[model samples]
Target: MKRLAALGWPALGVVTLVLLWVGAALYMGKPHVLPGPWAVAETMFSMRGPLVVAAAKSLSRVGVGWLAAAAVALPAGWAMGAVPALDRELRALLSLLRPIPPFVWLPLLLLWVGIGEPSSWMVCFVAALFPILAHARQGVAETPVALAAAAENLGATGLHLWARVRVPAALPLTFTGLKAGWSLAWMSVVAAELVGADGGLGQLILDSRNLARPDLAMSGMAVLGAVAAVTGGLLGWAERRVAE
Candidate 1:
């Protein structure tokens, strides 16, 4: 009974949304421009194989870029956060570069790397890097001085201090940043693939558009949204589990 009760709101919300969507699609009365849910579902069913492959490609790109971002960000963020002088030195440069939107780099990347997997990877890398670094830096910098002092008194020093005390303390904020960074990476990959890759959900959408199939375009978008939702749900679950 309790388990069923817990599921009530989510089920209700989903049903409400589906109703609203169906209402809108019916009102629009033009399947080409505003494909109904049924039409989109049919399209998705027909193209499941291609859609799954495209999703896998997109996920692979995101994994590559996100991992690279984390590799660069965690250490750099820790260093910047731990050392006031280093933070001051790089903050200005970070300021200058961080404001530039991810897609703005697309043109330069296109020129340098051309439209390919490399361009897509680079775009995802750029998109994921900044948030993780910013969050990580903030997390480390804000680690309580008392906590570090306690660790130092107990014989912890330098890397050990950071590893044992600061990093663990900073986990919450770092996790926040990591989650945000991965989302950015996912979005960037789609944007990159739209113009840069011959495969992936973005390319699927592009092809669907060129082929005058709104249903297929919606199907691609549906898959993208589903993946994002599932990833986010998993992250939330993990975070909650860790907290517990």
Candidate 2:
């Protein structure tokens, strides 16, 4: 009942949005320009086979890239947080790199890695790496110093100190990083794939546009949005679990 109440306003907002969309579609008086919801639904059902395949391809790319980013970032960030000297040396470099948009590196990545899976993966990696590293480093560095001291006093040493004290203490912020990184990776993967992909949501959108099928492009956008929503929800659930 409480959950229903909480969702009421959002449901109302969605209805309001739909009404506006319908009004716009009707007023413009051209189905080709902007199809109504029903038209989009009809189009979607008719092309469900190809749409599903494109969605799966994009999602697989995102998964591969995000997992790679996580594996690299967590250990590196943990190390930077654990050692003050390393942080001092690396902080300047990180600050320099963080502000540059990941897509800016797309050209160089293409040049170096060529237009293939490697290039797509590189874009996602670049998009995800900085956020994860920043968050993980912050999380580990901010673990209560007093608690760490107490652990040390209790004869916790090296890996034992990290395992017993640091990792658990830092998990919430690390989870935050993971979520941010995943979202970034998802978006970047699509953008990268747009230029070079033979099959994926990005390619679907690009191809639809090239074929002058705006409705199909819109459908592809909807599918991508749905995938992001589901992925984000799962990440949120994971965050809650770790925080708890």
Candidate 2 least-lDDT 10 residues: 189-198
* Top-scoring candidate (TM-score): 2
Q: Tens digits of per-residue lDDT for model 2 on 134-187?
A: 899999999999999999999999999989999999898898898899889888
The candidate that wins on lDDT is 1
lDDT scores of the candidates, listed in order: 0.91, 0.88
List, residue by residue over 127-194, the lDDT tens digit for candidate 1: 98999999999999999999999999999997888778999988888889889998999988888998
Clashes of each: 0, 0
The stretch of ten residues in a row with the least summed lDDT in candidate 1 is 235-244
